[model samples]
Target: MFLGLDVGTSGVKAILVDAEGEIAAAATTPLSLETPAPGWAEQDPEAWWAASCAAIRDVLARRPSARVEAIGISGQMHSSVFLDQRGAVIRPALLWSDGRTTAECREIVTRAGGEAQLRDWVCNPALEGFTLPKVLWLRNHEPQGFARLAKVLLAKDFVRLRLTGSIATEPSDASGTLMFDPANLRWSREMLDAVGLPLSLMPDVGGSAEVLGRVTPGAGKLARLEPGTPVVGGGADNACGAAGVGAITPGEAVSSWGTSGTVLAATAQPRVDPGLRAHTFCHVAPGVWYVMGVVLSAGGAFAWYRNQCARELAEEARDDILVDEAAAIPPGAEGATFLPYLQGERTPHRDAGLRAAFVGLSLAHSRAHMTRAVLEGVCFALRDSLEILKALGLAPAHLLLTGGGAKNAFIRQLQADVFGLPVTTVNREEGGAYGVALLAAVGAGAFPDLQTAVQRTLARRPPTPPNLDIHRAYEEVYDRFRKRLVAART
Candidate 1:
């Protein structure tokens, strides 16, 4: 058996998979994300480690230690985990969704020759959520902590260090740091210097499947694993999730709807969008690149609506509702439209002050109509990402859907209608963890290469296409959304 652990924003999940790619056992532990200030997101690094150990212990308790062969880890990308000289966390980790570093992002972009140079170097514009800006924020605000930084690590690298006593990061996760050169696959000394950060704080770069080290004796005891269990370097959660859904080759993509939504497409060459709307990063698979666009809020908007406006209905939803109330509303929500920017937006519109609203609402609209409009609004936002990919000449032939929101048949079909493409959903929703396990299997000599392992392990279901009439209707409504957004911006 191989063990894969995913340290996500909301929780930590551990999965034990056998040689045949079947899961033997799995466990999860809920985690909290703290918002100390507006636009700021933080999490205790120790909490991640504690949750991970607990998950691992629970999974191992259900199976024999002798069967466990290797371990792999995948986690949220672009989070800054600062370690002092004694290898202890100096401060809480700044997560990818945090947006407190706008000034720092501006400084870096200006120093790097503004937007043009940023696009040339990183294939994406500087954003407040990226690692470099967060580092700069610490430098300017918390000089004492900044001065004590011995090593700067991403989320998964910090977890790996606790497990194996090694400081290293894989290419996919490193690419999001804004201090690494994705094209060259190494730390960007020039960029670091430009941003007034020293390169010494960075971890050694490694490939996704590289064997960093083995679990230490103390870590082994806590997690109930065999000492010296080989630990392979996995990657960013989205990249690993993409791999788990078999989005490995060109013309294939993964559309994930979690707290935030993203559309990822793999390619052989790194292609930056001319508008700087999407990010191009190194893939976990060697010699490959993937482009991604992020929407700040997707499922999060629906959650807010359920908690705020539909509380009573939510309590009775399970038993009384035949289909999800949100799913029952007709296409276009009877001419009503929603702007899903409660937390602002990332892709296409890099606006931080953007607010959400339901426009064109009428007295005839019901609760189901509003709920369905929320879901469709999320899809429309993702379609902006798809349109950007299409403009970049990396149009995907099919899309693999994953994440909590993808479980809803209504939302899945809504995605199909919005994008006018065939949407495929996988049986395994443990995308990042499963992908990490597949990487561990390869690192432990269970497979020869990533491609072969993916081919053998990933299971696919039939494609669900959009209804032609609904698709046509959406095309016209989407045009109106575009026009309205432009007018609002003006």
Candidate 2:
């Protein structure tokens, strides 16, 4: 059995897969997040550690006889976990979704000489989501904590250090830090120097599939795993997610609508958007890369709608009940559009100050129309990423849909309509945990590579083809949505 741990923002998921790529057991333990201030998302590193151990122990206790051969870890990218020389977490980790570093983002650009130079150094624009901004925020606001910083680990690497006693990272996770050179596959010393930080804080880089360390006896006992279990240098959640969904080949992509939405496509080379609109990151597989566009609010926008607007729903317990309510309304929401920038936008417009609104609302429009507008709005926001990827010359054969948003048939069909492409989902929707399990399978010699492991493990659902007629109608509505976004900025 290969064990994979996805240390996510909401929870830590532990998945166990056998030699045939079949899941033997799986468990998820919820995590706690503190928005101590608006736009600041933080998590206690201890909470992640406890949740990871609990999830792993739950799965292991369920299957005591299963011998785990290797381990892999994947997690939310670009979260900053500061550690002292003894490797103690010095402060709560500032998460990827945290949007409190706008000033620091600008500071980084100015320090790098300009936006163009920063992109030249790291192949990514300085966004609040990236780690460098978090580091800078820490330096500016928490100088006492900054003085103790001996090492900086990404989200999963912190968990890996607890499990494997190794201080290292892989190319995929490293590339997202805004301090790593995605093109060269190393830490960006130029950016580090520009920020006046030492290179020694960065961990040694390795391939995602390579075994980086062994499980320490202390962690092994705590999690009911064998000591000396080989732990691979896994990957970022999205990279592992792509591997899990069998989207390793070029022209294939995964459209994930988790808290934040992403449209990710693997590529033959490390390709960056010249305009710095999309991000290029190393894939879990060697010699492979991916370009991705993010929508800061995807299902998250739906959640906000459900809470703030859907108090009258009969099925309040069902989080996706809004989609069902919206299902009664046909395409285009009868000329209403939603901005869906509740937590600000990411893909084409990297504006953290932008907010959401519903346009073209009339007395004739019913509550259901407004609800469907929200659904269509989320899809349209995701479509922004798809458009960016396509602009970069990527034509995905079909989008593999994942996340809670994909559960509703109406939402799935809505995505197909909005994107004008066929959509499918894998039989398992384990997301990053399943993906890293494939990486562990490769590391454990259960499979030779990610492609074979995915082929053996994951099965696809039938394609949900778009209705060209309905799709044609949505073009105008989507245009109105885009126009609202443009008008909002002004």
Candidate 3:
């Protein structure tokens, strides 16, 4: 059996898969975020370790006779975890959704000569969500912590460090740091120098599926596993999510709607957007790359609405209540529009200071109308990335839709209408954890390569075709929404 652990923003998930890619047992332990100040999102590294241990122990207990030969990890990308000389976590780890580094991002661009030069070097604009900005923020804000910094690791690598006593990261996660070159598949020395950081502060980079080390005796005890279990270098969450859905080949794409929304297209080459509107990063699959567009608040916006306005319906499932209310409203929400920038944005506009609002609201607009508007706004935000990808000549024939938002029929149809393309959901819609489990399968020699593993495990469903009339009607609404968003940013 192979084990896959995903250190997600909201929880830690552990799953065990057999040689044939069938899951034996899966478990998840919930995690909480700390926001001491505005725009600052954090979690204790120790909390991650504790959650991981609990999840792994539960999974093992469920299948007492299962012997795992190898392990693979996947995690949220671009977060910073600082380790002191003794390998102790210095502070709470910063999260990708955190927006506390706007000035630091600007400083990075300035040091690199300009936004253009920075994008030229890293294939992405230096944004607050990237890892380099978080490192710089620590250096400037807490000089004492900076003085003790021995190594900086991304979310999963830090967990991997605890499991194997190895300090290393994979290309897919490293490429999102704004300090690595996706084209060359290495850390950019010039980028490190531009940020006034030394190469020693970063972990060693490795292939996504390469076996890094064995689980140490100490970690084995906590995780309820034998020592010396091999651990593979895992991938960034979205990269692994793409792999999970069998979207690794060119012409395939995955649109994920979690706390954040992501539209990623697999490609043969590193496809950079000329305007620095999208991010080009290394794919976990060997010899390939992907371009991604992100929406900072997608399902998160709907959750906000449910918490604030629909609390009375909390006895029922929130999504079910939301869908029932929203399904009755028309596609355009009767001219009401919502801007889903509750945590700033990444794609199209890299503005970290942008805020969300409801436009064209009136007494005639009911709570149901607002509910549909929120769903429509999220779909429109996703389409922004689709538009950028099409501009870069990386359009996909269909999008493999995954996450909570994909479960609702109304929202899925809305995505189809907004994107003007077919949207699909696969049989194994397990997201990142399932993808990394397949990576473990490769590392364990269960399959010859990733493609064969995907073929054996993944089953596809028919595509949800778009309604052309709704698609045509949405064009004008999208244009008006885009114009208002640009105006609001100014």
Candidate 4:
């Protein structure tokens, strides 16, 4: 058996797969975020550690006799976790969704000479989601805490540190930091100097599928695994999710709608957007990279609507009634459009100050219209990424939809209509954990290569083609949405 562990923004998940790539068991532990201040998102490292232990134990309890041969881990990228010399967490880890680093992001751009130069150096724009600004924020606001910081690790790397007592990171996660030079697959000394930090502050980089270290005796006791169990260097959450859905080839892509919405496609080399609109990061496999555009809020916007505006419909936990009711509304929500930028946005604008809005509302509009507008709005945000990827020459043959949003057939067909592409979902909606488990199987010699593993593991359903009439109507609505965005920005 091979184990794949994913430390996501919302929870920790553990999935167990056998030699044939079939899942045998899985478990998950829910987690909560701490918004200590406006625009700040954080979670205690100890909480992650606790949740990981419980999830791992729960998975191990199922089929106790199963011998886990290898373990691989994936996690949310760009979150910063500072550790002292003795490998102790310094404070709560800042999450990728946190928006408190806007000023620090601007500082990075100025230090790099300009926005263009920063793109030339790291192939990415300085955004609040990246790690460099978070580190700089720590140094500026918490000088005493900064003094105790000896090392910085991304989200999963911190969990790996607890499990293996080693400091290491893989390329896929490292590329998101705005500190790694994606082309050369190494830490950028220029970026480090620009941020006024030493190169030694970063962890050693490794291949996503390569074995990093073995489980330590201390962690083995809590996780119920034997010491010396091989642990592989996994990948960032989205990269692994792509692998999970068998989107390893260049023309393949994954459309994920978790807390955020993302469109990620595999590429043969670094395909940085000339306008710095999308992100180019290392692929989990060697000799390739992945380009992605993100919407800061996707299902998150839907959840907000459920909790804040549609509470009456959620009494029996049938919040899906919103989608059911919205299905009765016509295309375009009858002239209403919603922007899913509650926490700001990435891709295209890269604007952190932009906020969400519902336009064209009238007294005739009902709750059903609002719900339909919300769903359509999320799909429109995804289309923004799809259009960007097309301009960059990385368009996919079809989109493999994943996450909770994918479960809604209405939204799935709506996504197909908005993007004017065929969309399909895999049989398993396990997300990143399943993907890294495949990576673990490869590392354990259960499979020869990633592509072979993917073909053997993942299966897709029939494609949902876009409706031409609906597509034409959405084209008009999308035009209006774009104009509204530009007008708001101006």
Worst 10 residues of 1 by lDDT: 314-323
Q: Model 4 clash tally?
A: 0
Candidate 2 CA-lDDT value: 0.87
Writing each residue's lDDT as its tens digit, candidate 2 over 365-442 gives 987898898888888988888988888889787899888767778888989988999999988778888889889889
Reference-based lDDT, residue 51, model 3: 92
What is the per-residue lDDT of model 4 for residues 1-490, given as tens digits with 9 covering 90 to 100?
9999999877899989998877899999999988887667898887888889899999989979989899999998889999989988898998888888899998998899998877777889999999999999999999999999999998888888999988999999999999999999999999999878999999999878889989999999999988999889999999998888888878788899988889988888888888889998998878878889999888888888878887665477656688888999999889888987777788777887777898899999998999999998888898899999998888787899988767878888999999999899987788889889989888888898888998887889999999989999889999988888853343
Better of 1 and 4 by TM-score: 4
Comparison by TM-score, 2 against 4, better one:
4
User: How does candidate 3 fare on TM-score?
Assistant: 0.97
lDDT of 1 by residue, 423-464 (tens): 987767788898899899999999998888888887788888
State TM-scores per candidate.
Answer: 0.95, 0.95, 0.97, 0.97
Residue 418 in candidate 1, Cα distance off native in Å: 0.8
Judged by lDDT against the true structure, how good is candidate 3?
0.89
Query: What do the candidate models score in CA lDDT, each in turn?
Result: 0.84, 0.87, 0.89, 0.88
Model 4 residue 384 CA deviation (Å) reads 0.5
Question: Which residue pairs does candidate 1 place in steric collision?
Answer: none
* Clash number for candidate 3: 0
